[model samples]
Target: MTEPVLCPADPAPVTLIGPPLAPGPLVFLGDHAGALIPRSLGTLGVGEADRRRHIALDIGIGQLGRLLAEHFGATFVSQTYSRLVVDCNRAPFSPGAMPEVSDGTAIPGNTDLAETVRADRVAAIHEPYHQAIADLLAGRRAAGLPTILVALHSFTPVYAGKARPWQAGVIHGGPGSDYGRRVLAGLQGVQDLTVGDNLPYAFDDTDYTIPRHAFPNALQWLEIEIRQDLLGTPDQVAEVARWLAPVLRDAMEG
Candidate 1:
């Protein structure tokens, strides 16, 4: 028999912010928005310090996504569990989805995970999160409303002791990443901003959200990454959103 993924007591896997029928053509997603683990998982045996790290969640994306959605009058969908439990951005059953180790830090909870446990995580977390996104977009399409999908994320300023220079990055892949490139150009036009075009990382084999919801539908989309340091406080979060919201608006309009 297949084991269940989440306990009956676990919180909902996805959080939908803003109105379902918001004004804008944008739908923002934060795959690693929260760092909360199920009470049963017990932090995946990780320490509090590591639990708060990037391996657990995208440091400030929850706030960032919320702010952008509010400013743009767009619908925002986010995962409220830690990526360490099951990365929503990755394909189910993929190694990166439930990484045993991330950026050289060992995840004790992930080690030697049983097949049943892995499947449970996917059933509980990954499946629901993606389903929410897919359903939201489908509803929009059925209503004949224009849609632009944007995935929000934050990256650690330094990884494995190596410092990264760009303040922000835009990840695009394949021929379908035209909207991503336009977002790159829009942000680049901002003054005093060092924006990387597919720097630090690129959208590739490990990405599931965009491929599953955006590309196949041929939706204009972008996966945006902000340096975690820039999102250290509420003011910082607003500052980034203030500049970024308009950039995205122009990208969609242009």
Candidate 2:
């Protein structure tokens, strides 16, 4: 018998906040929101401190996503498993989907994996998380509702001994990314904020979420990356949501 990646006691792979068919064009995604590891995974051979680090999850995204969802009255779908187990934003079985090393820290559990093990991670966590998003989008499309997919993420202020200068970043690509450009411009207009235009990362073939759900559907999409340090407290998260919500609302309406 094949062992399951998620036991019965494990948390559900996807956490959806707000109505699936909420009255709006915005849909928020927290692809790396949680830091939960399956009981079966045994911490993936990572120490406690490392498990709480950015490698395990995108810090503060869960709270921020929920706040944004409530503010916009849009659906917020988030992954509940650690990205160290299976990065839901990457294609299944891709190197990044189950990284062996992240930011120079080795992932012992991911170093040598049988194909079946990798498949189980995808089947249990990655598939369900994305399927929920897909199903919600399909339903919205069937209902003739316009959709704007916004992926929320957080990055460490420092990576591999180097400090990042940007307060946030907006990643967009392809011919259908006009909304993303508008968001970038809006963020740039914010006073005392340094926003990167795809500096920390870019939208490319390695990305699976937007390309998988947004591209073929031709939905306007934007992937926002905030510096993790800025989200260290509840007040900080709320402040971000406050400023960001208006920018997104204006971008969508403009």
Candidate 3:
């Protein structure tokens, strides 16, 4: 879907879908929970079939976000639009920020766009989400809560037909911290767990979430990745949540 339409019926669509439970050192965010292919955009060459791929959104981040929030008594923030419109994880400069192709699916709607159209995606989706995150972090800072930022995400097992073995990956931006170290240690006993420090992708300023917000302040944070197959369903989400809950508790307390 390359030909982008600047007007989406609803511009800013952020979904906070959980209780504002206890005040702990944890905050769960699903930067790509959105999967809405706005009605105005039409088909954009590829049909609804193509947009349903993992490239459009994190396969099961919404469920993961919810479980993490409830299990850890944390606040949750999620998006309600598809990443085919604009990727929340990517910095605005990254070409994939508004990708024309992801995995093997080509997004026809993202192809040709003038500055105004491009800016429209940013204004409608990116800015509002980032602003909300900023407000959350700011509030937590003022309230004296030890914030441990966790950006939940899921990755495809085979991209272009190659198998990926990492069941989970934790993206640690800074050198080291109690949060990152404890996370790695907690996950060590788990069988077949492939943990990547900067594996799939490293953190950079272009990453508006981790760098712009988490790293600059040296906040204890990690961008977590779970294999899509492992979390593509509700049962899967709950299982993964159980696997991660106690580890997160230790990180929050340690």
* Maximum-lDDT candidate: 2
TM-scores for all predictions: 0.96, 0.98, 0.89
List model 2 lDDT by residue over 1-254, tens digit each. Answer: 86678899999999999989987999999999999999988988999999999999999999999999999889999999999999998889889999999987899999888898999899899999989999999999999999999999999998878999999999998956889999999999999999999968888898889988998899999999999999999999999998899899999877
Model 1 per-residue lDDT tens digits across residues 1-254: 65355678878999999987775888999999989998778778888999899999999999999998888888889898999999998888888888999987899889988888898888888898988998898888888888888899999999878999999999998746777898999989999999988998987788888888887898888899999999999999999999998889888867
Residue 16 CA displacement from its true place in model 1, Å? 0.4
Please give the RMSD of candidate 2 to the true structure. 0.9
Off by over 4 Å in 3: 1-12, 19-21, 175-178, 204-206
Q: Which stretches of candidate 1 lie over 4 Å from their true place?
A: 1-5
Q: What local distance difference test score does each model get?
A: 0.88, 0.93, 0.75
Q: How large is the C-alpha RMSD of every model relative to the true structure?
A: 1.5, 0.9, 3.1
Give the Cα error of residue 127 in candidate 1, in Å.
0.1
Rank by TM-score, highest first. Answer: 2, 1, 3
Ranking by lDDT: 2, 1, 3
> Which residue pairs in candidate 3 collide?
1-107, 1-108, 1-109, 1-110, 2-108, 2-109, 2-110, 2-111, 3-109, 34-81
Q: Write the per-residue lDDT of candidate 3 for residues 143-186, one digit (tens) a residue.
A: 77777778888888887777877788776646435586678677
Best by TM-score: 2
Comparison by TM-score, 1 against 3, better one: 1
Clashing pairs in model 2, backbone N/Cα/C closer than 3 A: none
lDDT at 238, model 3 = 97
